[model samples]
Target chain A: MTDATASLGSAKTSADALFQRKRLTAFAVPAVIIAYLAYIAIAFDVVGLAQRASGENAVILASDSWSYKTHVTRDNRRGGTTYAIEGERKGAYEDGTRPAWVSGDEDSELVIDLEDGHVVRFLPDNAVAYDVPGFGTIEAQLVDGSLNTNLSDPVPDWINLSDQRMTVTTDAGRLTMTRTRTEVFRYFPGWELFWFTLDSPYHNRSFTEIALGDRIDPDRPNISGAMSDFWNNGMWRHKDVAWAIGETILMAFLGTFGAAMIALPLAFVAAKRFSPFGALRFGMRRIFDFVRGVDALIWTVVLARAFGPGPMTGALAILITDSGTFGKIFSEALENVDEKQIEGVASTGAKPLQRYRFGVIPQIVPILLSQILYFLESNTRSATIIGAITGGGIGLMLTQAIQTQKDWEEVAYYIVLIVVMVMAMDSFSGWLRGKLIGRKD
Target chain B: MTDATLSGPTRREVDRIQDSYMAQVRRRRMYGGLTLAIFVLLMVSGFVVADDRNAGGFWDGWRQMLDFPADVVSEAWEKRANLPGLLVRYFPALMETINIAAVSTLIGAMVGLILSLLSTRGLARWPRLITVFRRFMDILRAVPEIVIALVLIFILGGGPVPAMIAIALHTAGALGKLYSEVAENADLKPVEGLASTGANWTQRMWLGVLPQVAPNFLSYTLLRFEINIRASAILGFVGAGGLGFELRNAMAWGPGRFDEAAAIFVLLFGAIVFFDQISSRYRNKLTEGQ
Candidate 1:
């Protein structure tokens, strides 16, 4: 009884010690994490992040994503006023046509109500007037190769006045005047001319109208014509976007399946059961590790030098990097293959190829297929990144649009497309997995 | 006895079964062969189309593929003495890349833990809002880190913070999904016990579910850390600040700066392999228990 008590007492002490260690870690882990975070905050200059951040750019990106502006400009040299959406030639109003929001003809005082009690008047000879609701009317005109604005000694922060130029910014719109031209940007919500450009006869028609109405254009059916116009929309470039998405998917498809095809044979060599020579297996494994370690980014840069920038280069880069990963994964799966299955096949008087086909392939197919499908989905995302670097797909278009700094709308559109594309790929892979291998969940 | 009745009829029935089974086997083989044919067709056509879209055709390009690597290696060899100095110079950038990954992984894992716990069916605090959280995670995961990094870079200027934030957001989504998968299988007994003891949602999750899933969660976080290192480097290439940015600049300088490019390559490769080895080792240790 005394010996039992002593042993029980020792067990209690050991258990207490274990609890003590756990207790220390419970506090220590959080402490360590907090300290590391503090260090990162200092290292990353988090305190100065606010100062470095551009509020103006943020506002511009946010506002421009959902809103567009119409530009009314009068050239001092040419002596004519023209109206265009977002100042693009493709969105330009015809010589006599204009948005209903703009009142009066070009020959007379053109009054543009920017809404919210803010208005702009485009008068003759490159002269412009802007009326901010809270502020008084500000007038500007080009005079003798220089901009002259209304009298004010101390200009508000909203109005930027210089020797040769003046700009007045307000909630509703903006007005700018220079020797070359006087322009007013009237703000409007929503993406205008999204479905049809100014040149298309179906420009202002609704979806129902296009679907059900009498043919708007005599040359073609209404729905088809609208679709053609929308697909060919200069600003949106829906066709190019569709092709980009296709190319991205193509990269993922070719890369993943090609890698699988290449890796499967190589994986056999890497696997111990399949390959008798250990050295060859080691060497194959190293090759797999090297390729994986080299990474897609390096492969992209290297392959891009030879292939030049395109979907093919991105595809090849993905192919090479993923081949290594697939090789590693495939070999591991191959190594884990049940020997009983192979023996069963061999017992049936099967040849080596038949043994592999009957015994090994069946066992590993579901696992490999699931992995391949998962990679297929992920590679789509990778293809987007590779496309950006190597210049192909929606990623390229996105990077280019972003680099311009003013195509936030296009950037937004591309972002939506990319996200949709990735989600769709995810669903496709999931569906395929379910169909081929039975439902995982 | 039944001999007279069984003999001819039994033999004919066996023959019929054999022929029908063979026919069924043939049908299965035909379906498999058709699928294989379709796959081959897709592969061949895709290759051709990709080849067509390429600026340099595959046939022409494959031969010259080694040219750039050879030049870089040769240049680095000639300037071999500078490699050590170059590695030292770029070490801090490498560290920045590593730190971005570490910080993001930590942040992501912490967020992922909460998200997974909340999203899991039995563990959810608000069951009705589960789909809301799921779709939120889906959107986060759907967005490529480069998209957020590029946009953030515009607002924040070129920096590591953007990359960190971008990667962290993606990691959260990814780890959340993975963790929830693990959590789905977690025993609810401990959770029920804690709740019976008057524990709140956070308390129950912290004390019951977290301890149960910690090992798996840690293993996944380590794996994500390795991936995030690569991601952070890629982000840098797009101007988010790290080894990739330096490498880009070196490449942009053209021809003469191949030595610097080679050093950056060496550093990136070494770091990736090292982290991969270490993370996989620990992940093995963690997962081996289960």
Candidate 2:
């Protein structure tokens, strides 16, 4: 009875010690994590970041993504008004034409009736008047080489006035007057010139009219003309966008399959079971490690210098990087192959090549195919990033658009297309895997 | 007469079987050959098209492939004395890069843990919303980090925050899928026992489910951490603050600054290799159960 009691006491002590350690570890891990986060917060300067972030830029990006502005400007010296969409030369209204919203002629007073009772009038002598619905009419004029505006002593916060320029901001529209010109901007919903540029005859035509009505352009039929105009729209560049999307896909395809082809033989040499010589296997493995270590970003930069910026350079970079990864994976798969299959092939008096073909290749083909297909999907995304670095494909266009800072609509368009493209590729690869591998799930 | 009749019937049967076997072999060979032909055609045509669209043709650039590397290396070698100073100066940037990866991975794994629990079949908080969560993760995973980074940079200005957020978003989506797969196979006995004790969902998950899958979750998280480091470096190249940004600055200065670029390249490679080794070692241990 004394011995049993002593043994139970020892067991309880050990169990209590185990629980104590576990509780300590559980608390310690979270404490460590919290300490690290605190350090990072100071290092990253989260406080400063919050202050530095611009709400105005976010507002611009958000508004610009789905809306466009039409610029109605009167050249002070030239004495004629020109109307343009987003101030692009391609979107300029014809000399005799104007948007339905604007009234009067270029030679006379131009009245831009911004909706919601906001009106911007371009008077003679490089003068402009903006009538805000709630506030009184504010007038500005370029006298001598400076802008002079009529306002009370304390100007409203919305109107920014100076000797060189005057800007009026309101919910309905914006107006600015400088020594050289007076401009009024009217905002509108949806992308401007997305279907057709101002030069196209079918610019404002409805789809129903285009489908049923006679030819809008005398040179061609209605359907074909509209189709060509939309496809070749200079501002949106649908044709170019299509080509870029295709180039990105091509880079991924060529890189993925090319790497698989190159890696398959190298994988064999790297696999210990296949290669009897240790030196060759070791050398091959190191080569893979080196290539992988160099990484796609560095490879892209190096190759871009040699090949110049293009899709091919991006493809080659992906090929080099993925070959290393594929080689490692394939070699691992090769190492894990069932030896009995190889023995069976050898027992048939098969040659070395035949033995490999019948024995090893069959066992690893499903693994290899699935891996390659998966890489193909992922490489599409990699190709986009690599394309940005190499100056090719949709990524190049996207970066360029973003850098311009005023083309948020185009940026939004490209982003949508990229997301759609990637998701489509993902589903495609998944479907192909199901078809080829007989669906593991 | 009886022996001759049996021989004739056996010979005919044997010939028929051999003919059918030969036909099957021919069909298989034909299919294989066709696939090979299509693949070869696609490769050749793709090369030609890519060559046509490229600013410099493949053949023209092939011979000069190693020239840039040689030039950079030679320049770097001449300024090798400054390399140590450059590396020291850039060490902080390297730390920032690693920090971005580590923090993003930590936050992403936490979010992904919740997402995986919600999406996994037996562990879902709302069974009807599983598809919604899965699709949300899919969309998140589909967006390239650079796209989000660039957009964020415009609003947030050039800094590491954009890169961190972009990488975190991607990591969450990727880890969520992997974590869900592991969670799907988790033994539900502990969960049932906890449920029987009148424990709430959160309590059951924390006390029962988490311990059962922690090892696999940790291994996957480490692997994701490794991937996120590479992603953070790449995001840096596109104006996000890190070593890649410094490398870009040095490269922009041209030949005279090659040493700085070289130092950065060395640092990046070393960091990547180091993290890869460390994470892989830990991942192996976790998967192998200590």
Candidate 3:
């Protein structure tokens, strides 16, 4: 007893002498993983990563200046807005200081808009050449202050602002508006030409207001022309983006429903416990594994080769891929059914067919239905991948938008639409899955 | 004594019945043959449609896989300058994505474990909760990883973080559902014994319940790891970065770099297979020991 106690004491001392024992690893596995992944991030340049396919076509399509004309309207009911922007081709490069259209960038074309019958056109900051409808062609520099041309010498009656704000002598009358940052008509007038040019820091604050206090400063440059151009044109830029999103939705639905047709039925025979025959079951199971092992993009690329191009390619590719996935899932569900019910049917001297119909199918229907609904939700996103490959959907449009860097606003617009779609799908699927499985959402 | 007279009528009736049955069977056989023909026709049509679309370069892309070692090693080593750029751009994104995945998986696993614990009959009178959780899992699992990524990207913006979260969210749902099934179907005798002793929820779960389902949970988590890794790689295609970004770029701009894409793809697939094999073997050993 003395030796045991002594030994225990010694052991305790030695253990204490060693490193402190940790209940949890101070350096979590996630931390290590994060570090390792950070190494990979170091290798990739997110900004440099190109989102669009820069082919010969994209290269040749490049322009010095892109002019956009637009018409805009609001939909208060849907809480949605609609507009159209038309790009007029340009020739030759222009000064970099020129006021580009709003939401213009490298990957996208010119954007424009019209609000309350007033037309606005947005051009790229680097636009060298421009095409106009009635006026032939005009070249101009980007200015910070507002200037109105072609509206007559005296500003028109519609141009009336608080008379004391500022006076502009025109053919019709003297019209003026106060230049204040808080005014809805005002945007950042001048800022450094960066990647997101024009939408930079210069618009919101008036130089006159900041420098002259209560009075308008003589040094405040007028960017009214640039602002007017942007406001008039930028509103209509979202239409193209909307169209792109619509295409993606179509691709997803067609692919998902078609794939489900094959996957759901095949899942039954694939389940080892419920299979009609061992060989059939094994074969189906193997088929599922093979299809699912590959990436969907790989499938898309493959199908694109087989089918050529267009929405059909995207649809077929998704079908082939989803089949394998749904098959395995459905089969597992089949295997999990209560065997007692199956046995009960069997003891009645019913054939396999009758037993399956009465005992197996009904019990598994909800499971299968739930699976199908989930896959449908999944396929919608996959449709976007297909779009990337075939250039047929919103993904393709997004790629274009990213490449030109001309339609960031459109990019934002499409992003909103896609989010709304996916969220809607998620909610609907959750509800449906709950209903089929007899559970709450 | 009556056998001869009865036999004569029975023979006539049997002949009439047999003749009608034979005719019906012949008609049914023709219909069956037509149906089979239609089924075959549909299969062929699907195949043809698939064929006409894209001849599928994945098989061809495999050929590029062979060029990987030479090109990757050369480019990686010889182009030392580009290496820094590549590392700078890729490593952080990769780490961010992985972190996202790890955190998500950990949280998901906990949720799954908790649900599994609650699924036991003794813990609580909430069969409805279990049922609801299971269906919630179905909804969660049904959404494609890519779709999840896309939605998250929209909500969170383009980054590795969102991709990781997306993967983790789905993993939680799937793992939770699977874990619940494992718990529900576990041997209950010990559970009953523990209950008889008046064990509390946490205690019963720790000592009586967990020991039974630990192997299953481990195996599932490992399996999910393999899946999540592949998912992480692909998330890059949607602006999430890793090997997928490289693959996308290759596809988009530089087909010549396909060798790199092929190499990365091979690595991903190999990693999955290796993890699967190791996890399965380990799991089998564990279950055996248990």
Question: Number of the top candidate by TM-score?
Answer: 2
Off by over 4 Å in 2: B1-14
* Cα lDDT of model 3 by residue, B1-290, tens digit: 67776588797998999999999999998996997798567555544443343333334433453353445456545555554454555554445444555555766687767765665454534766866665667666645455556544543446665576678777877797778777777777886788899987677777787878888898888777756765676677767665666667765654455444444545444454555568668877877875
TM per candidate, chain B:
0.96, 0.96, 0.69
TM-score per candidate, in order?
A: 0.96, 0.97, 0.49
Poorest 10 consecutive residues of model 2 chain A by lDDT?
A: A103-112
Error in Å for residue A6 of model 1: 6.9
lDDT of 3 by residue, A345-388 (tens): 99999998899988898888887777777766766666765676
Q: Order the candidates by lDDT, highest first.
A: 1, 2, 3
Model 3 misses residue A291 by how many Å? 1.4
> After superposition, which runs of candidate 1 have C-alpha atoms over 4 Å from their true positions?
A1-20, A105-108, A151-154, B1-6
lDDT of each: 0.91, 0.91, 0.56
**RMSD, candidate 1, Å:** 2.0
lDDT by residue (A375-419, candidate 1, tens digit) is 999999999999999999888999999999987888998999899
Fnat values, candidates in order = 0.71, 0.69, 0.08
Candidate 3 local lDDT, residue A377: 70
Least accurate stretch of 10 residues (summed lDDT) in model 3 chain A? A181-190
**Considering DockQ, which of the candidate structures 2 and 3 is the better prediction for this target?**
2
